[model samples]
Target: MRDPDLDELRAELEEFAQPEKKASRSPREERIIAGFEEIQRFVDEHGRAPRHGEDRDIFERLYAVRLDRIRKLEDCRTLLAPLDRQGLLSGAGTTADAGSDDMDEDELAAELGTINGFEITELRHVRPSAEKRAAEEIASRQRCEDFSKFKPLFQKVQEELDAGVRETRPFELKAEIRPGAWFIVGGQKAYVADMGEVFTNDQGRSDARLRVIFDNGTESNMLMRSLQRALNKDEAGRRITEPVAGPLFSDQHGDEDQASGTIYVLRSKSDLPLVAENRDLVHKIGVTNMSVEQRIAGARLQPTFLMADVEVVATYKLFNINRSRLEKLIHRIFDPARLDIEIRDRFGNPVVPREWFLVPLSAIDEAIRKIRDGTIAGYVYDPQSAQLVRRGTE
Candidate 1:
């Protein structure tokens, strides 16, 4: 009963309504795009491209290497050029930071892996020979001869966990490997006691030896990759959070009981000749649970601000940390650079401000980096070198 003309019209309209086919990319191109996007995310969050340095976190160093390689390759530049809204690719060479080469381009690509939401292009049915050897090293654990020294640490971690001062969360990245970091693997609490110098493996990948102490008093000198693999394979693998004071910083926040605060670095805007002369070098480091704006209000009326207006140089938001202790710890690290200026309050009482230090902003950035990775305990800021040096080395 239908008209032939009506049927023909409906068929034509259906053809017009079909969706356009997306441009398909080759696996190699997809991998390149995925890797570049990771760098882009890093830039977005950190406000700068990752730089290379021993003081820099391992992941930042990896990103620095990755960015350098991407710049060198014409194909990567071409593929990522359209997506470089931040102009991250326009810079020449990698950041000039102090560190040796860890991984070449191909290995770095593999390390970045296929980013989430992308179809994974690479997979292996069998573990690599190097990874297999690392697994063996982990399996051949020895009784820690100096277990007594580490016993108190394990107990303290447990106490903190019970007291809700520290909590454990899922472990996701190999970059988390560092001294003083704790993890739960294979039904045991594992701690990274120390890490050795970064070295290139025979496979041309960046790696380091880790001294991992188990709560059971067994210890293993395993390659960093081994611990990563173990954690990835275990269903219950978790990274134990750090104590609130000697805090290990985590990005995750919980609703019930996570303490959050900000670490603010301030530069005095006083017109005083000495402060004006060294304005760029002097900074006040403080941590507060309230907003920085609220805390800095009435700066000109407060001796703590040198009785002058101030400029916020930087602020780092932290979670589940003791702001007071963190403030004190940072103060202690830069104590040698403490500014010796005396400012009078509205009551005409002279008071020497304790928080201000005559240190460059870059040095403060490096100190925060060490603190986030839980390595600040072993480092002290040397004003002569304007660098964070090992305790015994300086």
Candidate 2:
């Protein structure tokens, strides 16, 4: 048997469903009533309140329909009401209505609130495509996993930096300011720095300054050019510099061949201790499990330290670690080895012919922190299970 509330709601809907007998009701009012009946039918089928979940697509469509009805009803109200008092009827209309001016302000406000509440509720039902796109953009901006907490950490780092605390180590090296001798700093996907045109004065002395050139032809010269200037003062008057740029060698040959000599040149510089220090920090942060000593001892090891040439090396290393963790999660969730897995690119374009799953770095970091704090359930998928079973769900 249907519930008493459902029966009553059905009866109310039936009353509005019939043709209006009075002249007060118009075609717009009829359409509004029809829309209300549709909403009632949807509620009856769901047997619960509309909400955001896997079925968001349905929720949003219904919400938009409901809003359209409200708008039509508002339009009908405006047409029937007197010009001076029309605002009192629709609540949002701007008609001055001197007759309704004498009405209680509190009652008018309450009526306005009702309309606004309905409007806001409908707006919450955002389409999945738009929601997904917004989520991805937010994720990209926050490149790290723990974005929520990272803001404070980043602020603290910046504060320390402003107070002359060198959290980043700078590498010291002597390179003759010559043409085609560019040093790439940061990492494999390092943000490129511009090498400005070498300017020569009449005195025959070339002002050896490095300038960052953008695609727009604008330029920004390196502020602190010399290692002596960067390391002149340290904590308690001791000189300590952090490496922001790695070394690179370039010849007439392609960039790949140039990288070999660049690596060799960086490795031979034993006097500069920044590379070793950064390698140690990378291991300590758990981004890399291998120590510098172990890496040096390996059979595949070469004479050069390639770590010096990349720009923002430490940040990029962190980015890679985050990507690896996300890949593992995707593999576990879909179990590609067992099922027909399909992956797609950012634009929903087919990529790798396997199921693609993405978790924003910020979201992943926040999830990890929550798990540690015992605020949320933390689970990693097992490839053998081929199901989305929680870590302690047994």
Candidate 3:
């Protein structure tokens, strides 16, 4: 016979061993759940699921992709039965990207998220662009075991850039894009250090292999022609020169090869109710080949202007710079603060004006400064924190 205390302890242990009523969700299931929640939030705010188009928010496009992937998974749909308040799993909801029950090409295009003219769908029957192919090839490159040999070159470049001894210039694609040259590819400073055996192509063209290293400690062995093709397609790509024989940051307007454009940050001068309400935080960013005044002179009548007078808040001059690429980068950094409201044109047709975000003026100024110093690449604007934060660790 056991003592009463021992018997009581054994009973308590047995009771504690019983499984709970709910099972913990797996990582995959959790992700599916979160994705559905995000879609529901979009539907709630916009009164519909996120739509597909080049002009639409990239977040919405990504959500459309996620919804398509989830809707096809029967297991996911079943798992989300209780958590899904929006009937996302019932098959009753139509794909946001997919057009109405009528058109054929659009029905397919909706799933593909075809932006502007670019084919964004994962499953494509058409041939891929040369840029896309080259980008994929470069992306597939693994870590370089010999990164140390090239590390010093990047260090020296950074030091010279800091000391104002060397300056970067816009890249122009040429056949002489050979080894021992430095270029900015894929938005990262890259150096071509070595060349492999030359080979002939079916078109009677000569090309050679190259060992290129990026400032981010990554390297690749992409072909020479492939690098040129990639650069030509890249609007922001540039080639750097070895401490050119000139004064640093000098006015090179007469050089004939310098970039000719300006990046202008503007704010509306309209007394419109909405504009008045968010005037301080609401800002528009754009690039113009002409003076900002010339660009916005007729803004009051244009749909792109949201029918408002505007004032230039800031301006950054450029030389051989890709203005569109720079504008895209600034917009991307402040994307989290993007305003979701739509506007109407003078003709009463609905207009969705982009490039406007709810960021503070000081933050915008700081961002532009960071861009000039070339330190903006690794940083992103945090709307919640209302400041810049380093990528990844955030």
Candidate 4:
């Protein structure tokens, strides 16, 4: 009962709607493409092509090796040419190639499996939960998008370290994890850019998240507790102390200036053989808010005064500065000449006297003058020369 012309018209339309034939690739070809894509992802994330080196991450080394192999094979190059938007093939590979040319199908598969996501059972040696967390936290580092903004800061810090304006100390407490604080962990400088609001955890301990940026242009948002544990575990981890700043002394204290303390240079009057032999060179550098005479009273009764009366050789009044930090600075400057002699206190206990140095009064005066003018950071106390010389000269 149907018309032949109408049925013929529908068949024509269905024939025109058929999909086009697609190209087919074997499993080997598919695997090659997938591996190349992984290398491309690495380049995209790190802003550089992976290179072979002992210091590089394991996965990156594998990628470097695989890239070299792919470049050697004419077939792989032809297949990957269309996808080489990063011009990875055009660039030269690193000279530090490792391993043999025995990258068979099974070995390549194993390498690929070791990357991306990791399984606990795959680890050869099991680690504790905290250690595992710390490892994972460090491994999660990625290229920082705003690294250019921090490059200058890292350069400045390096300069300060070279000039003796900054010092590295053992990291011992969680209280040091504040914003703007810097540290050296895993052989890289880490700056604490920001920290989240403080909160107590189930263990009744305060904790917070930190945005830590690294000198290698990487960053991580690890927890404060996690960073603390990482620092404790890393042997090279250290806290970068803040550089000394502001004027150490002021004449005719202004109305707005707060009197901090005075830096007093004292020569010990101890009759010990070493002290008597080098009395002129044996001096105590101290900072105190109390009167110099009052602080030195009953010197013979105090172990810190070396159980001997002391003569105040010089004093420089300070304003609006941290007395303890200023004292630490002077102590560190003259630490090489520190008196190593030990004495017994009135209680019959052995006590080591600190703040006493074997430096001459002339050098101490020069250091005080440089410190007042903020040039002390560029100089150091040279025990051999018996003078304050430029830091690099010694």
Leading candidate by lDDT: 4
Q: Give the best candidate by TM-score.
A: 4
For model 4, give the RMSD to the true fold.
15.2
The list of candidate 1 runs beyond 4 A from truth reads: 1-259
Which residue window of length 10 is worst by lDDT in model 4? 115-124
Model 3 poorest 10 in a row by lDDT: 100-109
Which digits, one per residue and each the tens of the lDDT, describe model 1 over residues 1-394?
A: 9999999999999988969899999877887787778777888788788886423454565677777777888988898899988787888423555655444534433443423322124533333653454233324577899999999788767745653345788998888889989999878999999999999887788899899999989888888987887788879999987655343344455565455788899999898888999989989999888999999999999999999999998988777665666677788789999999997899999999999999999999888877665556667888899888988888
- Residue 178's lDDT within candidate 3 is 74
lDDT values, one for every candidate: 0.76, 0.31, 0.67, 0.77
Question: 171-193, model 3: which lDDT tens digit per residue?
Answer: 67565477778888667888888
Question: How do the predictions measure up, each by TM-score?
Answer: 0.42, 0.19, 0.42, 0.45
Candidate 3 error regions (>4 Å): 1-143, 146-259
Provide C-alpha RMSD values for all models, in order: 22.8, 26.3, 21.3, 15.2
Tens digits of per-residue lDDT for model 4, 302-345: 99999999899988888766677778878888998989999999
- Deviation from native of the Cα of residue 213 in model 4, angstroms: 13
Candidate 2 weakest ten by summed lDDT: 257-266
**lDDT at 352, model 3:** 87
User: Distance from true position, residue 259, model 3, in Å?
Assistant: 4.3
Our tally of clashes for model 2 stands at 26
Superposed Cα deviation of residue 169, candidate 1 (Å):
11
Worst 10 residues of 1 by lDDT: 112-121
